[model samples]
Target: MSDKPYQDKAVIVTGASSGIGRALALRLADQGAWITLAARDAARLAVLAEECRQRGGKAIAVPTGVTGEAQCKALIERAVAEFGRLDVLINNAGIGATGLLEELPDLTLFKRVMDVNFYGVVYCTYYAVKHLKQTQGRIVNISSLGGKSPLPYNSNYNASKYAVHGFSDSVRMELAQAGVSVTLICPYWVVTEFHERLMDKDGTPRGPQGRAIYSEKTMTADQCAATTLKAAARRKREVLMGPGWLTVWLRIIAPGLVDKITIEMVLKPLVRRAEKTQSKE
Candidate 1:
């Protein structure tokens, strides 16, 4: 394997506006990759594309909302047209929601989460598979620990990730013979804007205290991105970061204990914080 695996390779990173996706794109830029930055925020993507160019990679900013199939198709088409071939597809676009399932005002919240987190992945992969097979390239699906172990008050988010988990695994099997590799990345609590963007029962962003509690724990986005790239380079089928594996193990060996910990240590703190924030409001 080359020291710079991404050198000259054409890679597409969804959710390139910020968080893990942004971090990963910058790192790939450092490796001299030809990068296609995809996200809804055109301004952010443009800025990131310039940064990638400064870091020694060729980059193009494509403002894309991955939830739509036509948009996803266009993203792939544009990347191939620019770079001539597709080497990697990072399905890093995702959204989050909080609140117990029953507390949610309507099931549309679930649909909204699923559309971005799950269907976005499906649509991108559907279009990218043929190109990936042509290059014997890779597909990296960004998932979460919640996908493996149910997290309290995050049913919508969990369900979407769970679907991603299943989809990635099934696609890996289907594409194995085609020389297309699928890697699923599950990370627990990375310090990202994800928490701040997490929606509440009414589809509004959750309070600051909820975001703060998560930032207090876990690794940074850069750390997660570095680990992710290493895993992708090795074509790892699945990689769990931070306390992700421990949480999954505990869930298997001591399901009840895991449940208690999730409720007491994780869920209750957020609930208390939310209540405290609401009291002041």
Candidate 2:
């Protein structure tokens, strides 16, 4: 669609059953890429694969739980076996939780968040690197704006994303010489099922706490997917999407000021509202 010539290329999209992952997979399919859709939801993956094929693209659904190393390895193996080569790997699968550090039980929530967000990216990158080195391909990691700027009540999520920024930057340096590119996509508050899945310390849903700060600025999954693919095509080191760009820049220019502002303007208010909502419920 971009006239950039992606026909017949092979791509692997993790968490491809829904949301941003699904949007990316379909976009690549439109570019005539052979897609390997990986997700834990086999049924949803199957439906997505069918949709891709219906659009006249080659696609296969591979059920994968990227939190496990073996599953990540199997996913790459299946992609290679099916497509013979891998051109791109989109590390998009992730989960989120909300609570204070003290509210969480030790590092359980932190570990779980990192396992899927950071470790899962690591596992997929490890396997994909071997193939990508051979093809001189690309890796696009779906990171959140939270990775660049800290967000209260979502410390675990922010930490995981920060780890991703560090990891991706290191890999990009290591792979630059090999002609294997790495791109990080940082998006802010896209309207997705992510909120519905957000959990508390007891694994209970964290429903709408208060009026969202960026409630009116929600970007669609398709818009995010398109921006991500464009970034990949350009081989950009980083792409910041949505209105969160200013916040990320502020963090770089004046960390303490932004930190104080974020705490005062966003975190405390949101926490109080959440507590009030929980009390009512």
Q: For each candidate in the order shown, give its overall lDDT on alpha carbons.
A: 0.92, 0.88
lDDT of 2 by residue, 63-148 (tens): 99989999999999999999999999999998888788887767877898999999999999998998999988999999999888
TM-score of 2: 0.94
Q: Lowest summed-lDDT stretch of 10 residues in model 1?
A: 208-217
Rate residue 177 of model 1 by lDDT: 92
Task: Give the top-scoring candidate (lDDT).
Answer: 1
Q: Which pairs of residues collide in candidate 1?
A: none
Q: TM-score for each prediction?
A: 0.94, 0.94
| Local error of candidate 1 at residue 168 (angstroms) | 0.5
